[model samples]
Target: MKKKITVALLTAAISLSLVACSNKENVSKNEKLEDTVVVYTTHKEEMLEAISDEFTKETGINVEFINLKGELADRVRSEKDNPQADVMFGGDTSTYMQLKEEGLYEKTEPQWKDELDKSFKDSEGYWYGTIKTPVMMFYNKDLLSADKAPKDWSDLTKEEYKDLIVTRDSLSSSMRSTVCALIENNIKTKNEDAAWKYLTDLDKNIKNYYNSGSVMYSAIGKGEAAISIAVLSDIIDNKENNKMPLEIVDAESGSVVITDCVAALKNAPHPNAAAKFVDFVGSAKVQAMIANDFNRIPTLDSALKDSPAWMATDYKAMDVDWDVIGKNQSKWIEKWETDIIDNNKVEKQ
Candidate 1:
């Protein structure tokens, strides 16, 4: 009887030990997962790397990112069933809105949420803006005098500017936003026909549509083209850092200002890490650092105060409904390509 009782007690103790071991293993695995974050972004490699390095240094959380440029959103959509990234960063708010509508984001209220205006963040907390980007017209000062340069989107279609305008491919986010703004502008005036007509006329003057931003900037610097359109940050970078003779055109019709944003993916593998990263990147200190270092405009009201003086320069902002643009963007790009770009290619051939 005593021997049987000893055997039963030993067996029960062993069973409890096994359960404890299994629980420890799971806790270890979760801790490992929390130590790393995977990111997908449209930002340039240099900028992404720098920011990620800072994040890792501050939080001891590793950051592994893929720079997908214009392909980031589509990639996220394809990976919806099994998301490969914990976070998505650096696209305009319109792209984020579309993704949010598809239920692809994890709602996270970053620490800086209340520091920004309602327009800079999604109302339900799905995404938040990190920077402000104004899509503006630029001219090579050496090639075309300020007086002769196109002053507005409408002026680009003028006969005198023929064969002088160069632009990024339609797939570029900046170009897409600009086109959508044009469409929205005309739609508000109840003249959609005028928008299509304007695009067709502008297409006639385009010297070349380069697929690469570096190549396009090179062409402008080398006098291959005198006028172009790009985000303000790039224009400032080229003019100030690269010594390119580019100057911003104070477009009479105003620029389409886009709020570049960040969000965590739905069902991300590391939800806690994603939320922490989102908060870190959009914080006032980080936003100010980005604005000062990269020539970006900050979306945070407090961060804006610390930004460079040039960011304070006044420029007209076109009134735009980003949600409306987000819903119609894909179709508008398709129509632009099919009607304007393809037809022009056929004419040239």
Candidate 2:
């Protein structure tokens, strides 16, 4: 009887030990999953690193990022069957809309979703805008005074400004937004032909089309080109940080404000980490930090309040329908590339 009792006690002890071991293994797996997040971004490296560092400090989750620039959207699409990144950060709302239509984004509402305006986010909570980037014209102040600089998009096509303008390649989202806004505006007021005519004339003055923003910035700074169009944030950064002789041209037609957005991938390798990252990036606190630190215009109302005083400088916003632009973006881009860019007779100066 004594031997049987001892044997029963040993069996109970072994079962408890096995159960504890299984629970520990489960906990270890979860911890490993939450420790790091992989991100694919189109944002500049400095801004990405700054935001990533802050997120790491706050959440203790490491960030590994790839700056894919123009290739970001295509890469995401190619990897739809098996996603490698946890999050997709940067790129304008229009791109996000296209991706959302393809069902590539995971619908996860960040905590700060309610703080943004309806225009800044998707109604279905697929993606959230973190920055408001205005696509506007700017010039090298040393080369041309405010009075002489192009006051509107039409001014670039003038005979006097010929060979004085440098433009980004059409692949740039900023350039696409600017061109689409002009096209949409013409479609509303006149007809599509009017928009094409304007673009064709504008192309006549182009000294060169640069595939890299940095190269274009250098060309303007060095007086190789006197005027160009760029996002307001980049203009400010080049002027203030890099000491580039740049000035903003508040176009009479107003600027097209691109809502730069963030979203998690549909079958992300680290889903929990991706959800946390999406929430953390668009949070009011981080938004405000980005605004103050990087000269970015925050999309969140509360964050906008904490932004720099320059953000309060009022300028007219182009009255273009973003939904319409999002839907026909590919078609417009294709036509522009084939007709305007490819077939242009203008020789680079």
Candidate 3:
């Protein structure tokens, strides 16, 4: 799946190349990217830099972030007996939950364990969430006005948005989590059939589901697609930095908030360093810095005390039972692949 996505992304390199900025900072004479504790991540390069640079500054521990768009859990499972990375960071809660169920984590209590919301951390000390981000619809300002654009999930199926939508593969944790939330919402409302029907129709409007988040966002920025189902933070950051003609709309049914997590791998090459990194990231200081600068909702309650105006402390999010979703995700993904994606034949731009 990762290889397939990589190939598809190659064609969009012209547009997506602008998405990443050089994060290389001059390391001290003794520092090198190769010497850092290895971390497997799905975080954007810039975000990884922001957290890593701060971690290095605070602890003098060089951090090497290996950003993977897909196959994080699969890779971890394959390397379970002999781990390749010290920690897994930046995948959604569902991914961590699945990993935990597979016994892929090394249970250890971090210093900031008590500081996090119980819902944001594993009861068995497997994984800890750093922040939560909403799944939202981002539309191109050049293609549609605010009044004319889709405001919610249901709006995407309307005729106006046909063939103008772009999104990440349903297998991506972020996209899968969002779809799981929508399905759960429908089940709660006793509209299971309607939910599947809505997804089938929405699939008609999507030009293609890209292999990576950067390419998906880049497609929207370059006007290759008018709308994208992605994280609100990605849309905001891209608009602010790339000056893309994009606007975010929270779904009317409330957004699905995905908790990004960090965890120590079993038989980790650098257990102490991984534990230290986990504690430092979830600490009040780093949490507040991330919340203020990146617009991510801090997982620690105290971190919100000084949150910026853009961060909403009291917003209604769709309630999702992550454990249940984690258990059934493979089944759901299989259904999605056969029923929605394979069944729909849309031409890619």
Q: Which candidate is the best by lDDT?
A: 1
lDDT of 1 by residue, 250-323 (tens): 78878989888999999987788798889989999898989888888998879989999888878899889888
List candidate 2 segments past 4 Å from native: 1-33, 342-349
Error of 1 at 276 (Å): 0.7
Worst 10 residues of 1 by lDDT: 17-26
Q: List per-candidate RMSD values in Å.
A: 11.5, 11.7, 7.8
Q: List the residue pairs that clash in candidate 3.
A: none
Clash count list over all predictions: 0, 0, 0
lDDT of 3 at 256: 87
Per-candidate TM vs. native?
Answer: 0.87, 0.85, 0.79
| lDDT: worst 10-residue window of model 2 | 14-23
Better model by lDDT: candidate 1 vs candidate 2: 1
lDDT (Cα, tens digit) per residue for candidate 3, span 1-349: 0011232242242122221123435333453322345678876677678888777766556676666666677777888887867889887887789889898998868778987888899998999998888787778989878898887778888988888998888547788888877776666677778878878888888888876677777777777878888777677778877788887776677788999999989887667767777777888888888878777878777887877756663445777888877877767777877778843443233
lDDT (CA) for every model shown?
A: 0.81, 0.80, 0.75
